[model samples]
Target chain A: MKADTNLSEGSGIPAEARKILTQIETDRAAYKRKLVISFIILAIAMIMVLIALKLDFRFMKNQLPFIFAGMGYTLLVSFMAISLACFLAVVGALGRLSKNPVFNSIASSYVSLIRGTPLLVQVYMWYLALPQIGKALEGYGFTGIQAFFTLPALTAGILALGVCYGAYMTETVRAGIQSIDPGQTEAANALGMTRSQTMKRIIFPQALRVIIPPVSNEFIAMIKDSSLVSLMGVWELSYRAIKMGRRHFQSLEMLITVALIYWMMCILLQYFQEKLETHMARGDRSIR
Target chain B: MMENDSPMVKITNIHKVFPQDVHVLCGIDLEVKKGETVAILGASGSGKSTLLRCINFLEEPTAGTVEVDGITIEAGENDKLRNGRIRDIRKRTGMCFQAFNLFPHMTVLENIIEGPVTVLRQKKEAATAYAEQLLQWIGLSEKSDEHPSRLSGGQQQRVAIARSLAMKPKVMLFDEPTSALDPELVGEVVEVMERLAKEGMTIVAVTHELHFARDVADRILIMDNGNWVEQGPPEKIFNNPEQERTRQFLAHIL
Candidate 1:
């Protein structure tokens, strides 16, 4: 309370307001400590549940190799989808930020439509509607119709996920770009750098510091969202789990096994995210 | 057509209006010959800074014609100067900012060399060599490798001047270059500007430092309410101001 009063005195904030703020800070810290203890207890309880199910876990053990094999596919799909999403996100961010009415409208519409509709519906659209268009093109005697529009389920899943995530990431990218002080751009312009040159050399490089952390978050979320692709018959973690569980009527065990694997994968992704954040923050003097 | 006789910077009938229809600069006309230093003094909202910014198209004049180093550009129907001509005009002038915008991510040396290497297509080795020279001139040779964030306010501002000078522009513009510095730090930046003036760099500066204006300026112009209210030599303007507003302003600031 003495420290709080001293801080309030120096800041010129009323003592009453400082008291309320100090109370809120104390309450939040206490809540966080309690939450940490609760999480440890929850982990112990989960381990006990695993021990109780050890008797019937033999079948789940046998299926682990089959389901674990799907990790490779999940990583591959997510990697490719993220790459595509990064490209689309840059273009979408530019369009949204551009002064041209046409570009602004197009970017706004794409983000609105994709965010408004369900990802599930978009996935199904790619799988079903694309082939219908292919057939229609074949009737019209388009020579490359078969190859161009013959949409594979895996490809459809990747495209759907990429497009959906790209829309969300556009907002993150735009905000990162906007966070830079306008004075930096004015200085660059005064030095005679073209608009494109300024963006490539000054703006984007600086924006990467703000962008990388959120982008890594999106990548982690994308790993979980990749499971949605299983609906299209892709042999990812969830799809394999469903098929094996249904064949032997061990659905609960199969589902629990895949969930644990997903959790472990997220933990690994989180470690990488922190490493990347630290790397990007190297030039920032305040971080150390 | 008057190539040799024209002033280095000749701005004709400039006006600036914001989107809300607030006229910040109203029908301003000015000229600066080669090797002449003009200081603009005004109250905070008098548009002196806006007038300096328009010379290089940093803040495009809402309506005007600007000619710098024999190249003329007029604001088109959309109230924007042609992009090509704007870049051309900007290349002919170096601008120092109030806040010392020195590209915080770069070291002092890198900030100075960036313009020449990127815009002028100079070799990296040559740009770096010249940047080292500039750092020496600013009395900051030891601080070249240090980032802007690591330097003191005075050091940062000196580096900003060195950064602008690297371009080798025909004229230099200073927009309240010392207003953001501490009282103790303002002297160092003013020292550098004084050195530049002695070396005959054509300069147009908007400043609140009247003593700096009185000591270094050839001509001093006073602006108020979006237009020029008085103009004369520094001695005449400071010692024998004819207008009541000029006398009042000088009395307050002096």
Candidate 2:
């Protein structure tokens, strides 16, 4: 009976609702200020672009579709690479947590080796060194399909991006695991659940709130960096941009168009990321 | 479905040692009767908590045996029991942490039913009914959909107790349940524990709460430097302590 009264006390219209409403209004005002500041910053940056190269906007209309075609490739490469990275990341994280010496060492070396080397070198290795691997396979009494295999440019690009991002994701997942309090696992263990069950049911769900933001950031960056695939001749956005520019001899126009495309993509992605973060946060919120 | 004839718990010659020559539990020897409430008290670093951990096998004893309800934690030079059996032992013992480590992700109802559905494989309807009852017992029925962050520290601790209770453990261990809570909120959680005590649950509590130690405890064992200094009925131990160290601790706390 007593606790019932207290429960009613907690929910019967919070006294600070007015204050909270005012705070919300203040936040709205802050948002408007932020928008203005961003607009000003963009305007200034655009002016510099015009002044530096004597740019003309009339050409922007002509080049838009060509630029977008390149963007399509960039987007494809990033999406495929990110999906692969997610698989590698989850498996790699599990490997790092495994008790076996070999699993832990292999995962550790993967993260360590990838993180230690430059991304450019890794791209080169995947492109240039793989033929040697194929030839070696041929020497090992392997002939038909295995002997003379060749990775497509797109495959090489995906491998480079996936392997690089997976290393970073491994750490993100590790931090997410480490950030969770030890007691959650202890409680799960105290329950009749196995190790994997505990991780899946208790640890992973909570870790998502921490993991989502960083992973989204990585995906956005990958979109821009997918241009690196141009080196391997994957005719993605940047590759097409360079080709289009060389043909037109209006390199500045092509580059400016490419920059605008990236800006639009980043903006759209940033909005979605914010929405997702808020959505994930709703589960853990205690309205009081 | 626990049987009356099954041994609830049995522990013998539990020992633990740490590096740098520090001994956490030199040789812990204790037995808890089914439906008995025992309170263990120690000044500080006396291994009272360690002894409880050993019972739960959270910390494996360096060289001894512990059994709960006919299940033993110690193996013969090598652990032979399958992984599932070990989990059974853990499920049978409900533990209330001082800091109230509630899973922040789940709702209060979800927290309570997690062990039941995930571990015991109880159906959702049954687990929900049981969690509702437990939450009622802890006075958190209305807050079932709320997260731990929305609740106060005392409320979170009560939710933690409800979460543990959802599993229907045979024995419960309270490691200073009220220590992390504010003074104002301590009584509510204590009231719930007092009811649990009255229900004749087998409980082992380590606490500095003199009042609870005085009122609900059937027996009080005092520890100092990883050894039991003395133990007896609550009245005799609190009113007329036999050991000098016990007296000094009582005086310091009182």
> DockQ of candidates 1 onward, in order?
0.50, 0.41
Q: Which candidate gets the maximum DockQ versus the true structure?
A: 1
RMSD of each: 5.0, 5.5
Off by over 4 Å in 2: A1-45, A48-52, A145-149, A280-288, B1-7, B80-82
> Model 1, retained fraction of real contacts?
0.64
- Which candidate number maximizes TM-score? 1
Candidate 1 runs further than 4 Å off = A1-39, A52-55, A139-141, A286-288, B1-5, B77-81
What is candidate 1's lDDT per residue for A1-288, written digit by digit as tens?
A: 576666656677777877778888899899999999999999999889877876358898999999998988899889999999998899999999999999999999999999999988998888888878888888898867867876888898889999999999999999999988898899999999999989987888788789999999999999999998899888999999999999998888999999989999999999999988777777667211
- Per-residue alpha-carbon lDDT of model 2 for A246-285, expressed as tens digits? 8878788778778778889999999999999888777546
lDDT of 1 by residue, B1-254 (tens): 46546799998899999789989999999999888899999989889998898888888789988889888888654535568778888888999999888887788899999999989999999999999999999999998888898898889889988999999999999999999988999999999998999999999999988667999999999999789989999999999998999998898889
| lDDT by residue for model 2 (B1-254), tens | 35655546677877788778788876777877788788999987889888887777666678888888888767335655646567878889998888787878788999899899988889999999999998888888899998889998889988888888888889998888999888998888888888998998888999988778999988899988888899999999988988899999999888
Q: Which ten residues in a row have the lowest lDDT in candidate 1 chain A?
A: A279-288
Q: Would candidate 1 be rated incorrect, acceptable, medium or high by CAPRI criteria? A: medium
Clashes of 2: 3
Please give the lDDT score at residue A216 for candidate 1.
91
C-alpha lDDT of residue B99 in model 2: 76
Clash pairs, model 1 backbone: none
